[model samples]
Each structure stands twice: as structure tokens, then as C-alpha cells.
Target: MCKALSLLANSQNLFVNLARVAIFIVMIWIGGLKAFQYEADGIVPFVANSPFFSYFYKYEAPEYKNYKNPEGKVVAKNIEWNKLNHTYIFSYALGVVICLIGILTLLGIWFPKIGLVGGLLTAGMAIVTLSFLITTPEVYVPNLGGDGPTPNFGFPYLSGAGRLVIKDVIMFSAGLICASNCASRILSCCACKAK
Candidate 1:
């Protein structure tokens, strides 16, 4: 037990590196998916509602609700609407940015200066994503009338989208951690050079 504890304790740096790798993997996979039609369509609510991003779309919030394309399903009119809104174009550009951030983060394994920038960008991206929880109405369960008043249809109650957005908190922390680690490395190099 003591041996295992010691090994685990000694592996902090390894785990941090692993976190960078994990970030890289997640960013790459999710970013890559943005190029696809379904994935691009899925982000409409968040983007359309976001004050920071709503301008990217031709239509306004709530307008996108009418054009949603469920995963694995498609309708021509909806596609045409999305095209007019430049959904795919925005998504492609976002994907490229995400992929670049991931690459920069992964490169942090060796280049502390670059890694620091990457880590900060990762945190920034996560912050933007987390903002969707507040800006996107879809993030919460709506009070859709049913047999009676829905017991859980607001604030504290999280819909699937809310749950998804909430998870960005982890990415935010990891990005800070990576940034700190790189900063430490950079400082240490500077100190050694002074000697």
C-alpha cells in the first residue's frame, strides 16, 4: 500500500502530461466532428443564442429551433436554411481553431512557451463553451406542458445540453494546470540560464 501510494504520489507530472494528451484527444475529436453536417447543426442553439456568437448566424435565437436536424436525420429545407445561415462555414472555421489549440497544447510536452499559450487558449475556449449554459435556453429543461406542471423544468434542472456544457469546467481547470506547469518550466529555464 505504501509503495503504491508513493508511486502514485511521484506520478503527478506524468498525470499532468496525460491531462494534456487527454485535452488534445478531446479537442481533436470534437473539433473534427464540427465539419460534419449533423454536428454543425447540433451547435445551432448554442451559437444562435450566444451574444458572442449569434452574429455568426443569419437567423436569430429561437429561429434555429425550427430548423434543428436531429442526429442521423436530415431534411433538405433544413440543410438549405443552415447553408444560408453559414452554419457549416462557421463550424469549419471553429474546428480549425480548436484543432490548432489542441496541437499547441500537445506540443507543450516540449515547448513550454508554446504550451503556455495553448493552455491559455484552451481555458479561453472552455470559458466560451461554459457560457452556453447561461446564454442557451436549450441548456435547461423547458416547461413543456404535460399531464401537469413539470416538476423539474428550470434553473436547477439541467437538460442534456446543460449537462454537456457543465463538463467544460474540467477543461477549464486542466487548461490552467497545463499553463501553470509550462510557466514553471519556463521560469526554471530562465533561472538556470542566469546561473
Candidate 2:
């Protein structure tokens, strides 16, 4: 068993292949959950209510907030979901994009290029989410002195947004692996080289 483990660890191809497989499985799992709304033990709600996901659930539109424009007048208002009609659509679209990126990453069809693009997009989303958090701190705090603190108490430290950031970082690392050593790696793991 130790010999086998050593052999696997020493094989770069095996490591990359395993990374690809693991990434694929994760994509499928997350995509499946989003596509089917699969709820296990009410975990979905808990995740949705998590503080890390607070940005996704509640957005404070610039228009709603009392912010002065260049002319010193309030140009943007504080926009809330109740007043918006397309929030759900936007949310679903973002979800779909994330799932699509995951699927493409799993397939490894474009080697490093596709994975790189996905990673960049994921990073962008994470940045946007972080910006939102910085811009709107109230959404994360408890309202009306509610029961306990929000679900995801340690949001910025380990929220859904943080998870995505980490995932994208891994994806980007994989992309680098593909970009730097794609030719040899593909020759060993994929059938592209045979043709």
C-alpha cells in the first residue's frame, strides 16, 4: 500500500488526472444541486441564509442609498428586492453561469484556456461579492434585534463567497497546470495526443 501511494504521489500525471476528476465531481454535485434545487436535511436554506451568501440574497442598490453624485445631489437610491422585479432572474442567471463554468472545467475540453476563463470569471464574481459586502454592511448585521446572529456568522472568513474564491483559485491553478504542461499531460491522460 505504501509503495502504491508513493507511486501515485510521484506520478504528476496521476495527480493532475485526480485533480481533474475531483473538480469534475464537485462541479457535477454543485450543478446538480442548482439545477434541481436538491435539498438535503434543509441544508439549502441554511446555506442560503448564511452570512457569506448575504450579498447574493440582499443587494443594496446604489440608487437606494443616500449618496451624493458629482453635482452633490443624490443620484442613486437604496434599492431593495421587494421593489425590484428581476432579482430572481438575475440570481438564476448568475447561478447558471457558475454551473456552466464548472461543467466546462470538469470536461477539460479546452485544456487550460477554458479553465482559465472559468477561473477568471469566478474570481471576478468573488471580487464583485466582496465589493458588495464592503459597500453594504447592514445586510449582514441582524435586523430588529432578531433571534440569534445570522446563519453564517463568520462570513468573510468562510462564507460561500470565500468558497467560490477558493474554488476559482484552484481552477486557476489547474489552468496553469494545463497551460504550462498541457501537451505532455494530455498525451498521458487524454486521447487527444493519439489523434
Which of the numbered candidates is closest to the native, going by highest TM-score? 1
| TM-score for each of the candidates | 0.96, 0.45
lDDT digits (tens) for residues 50-141 of candidate 2: 35543553333342233212222222331222224233343455557667766555455446556545444544544544444343433343
Q: Candidate 1: misplaced stretches above 4 Å? A: 146-150
Task: Report the lDDT tens digits of candidate 1 across residue range 1-195.
Answer: 999999999998899899899999999999999999999999999999998999998988898878889899999999999999999999999999999999899899999999999999999999999999889988899887646555678797899989999999999999999999999999999999999
Candidate 1 clashes: the total is 0
Question: In lDDT terms, which candidate is top?
Answer: 1
Residue 103 Cα positional deviation in candidate 2, in Å, after optimal superposition:
2.0
Error of 1 at 75 (Å): 0.5
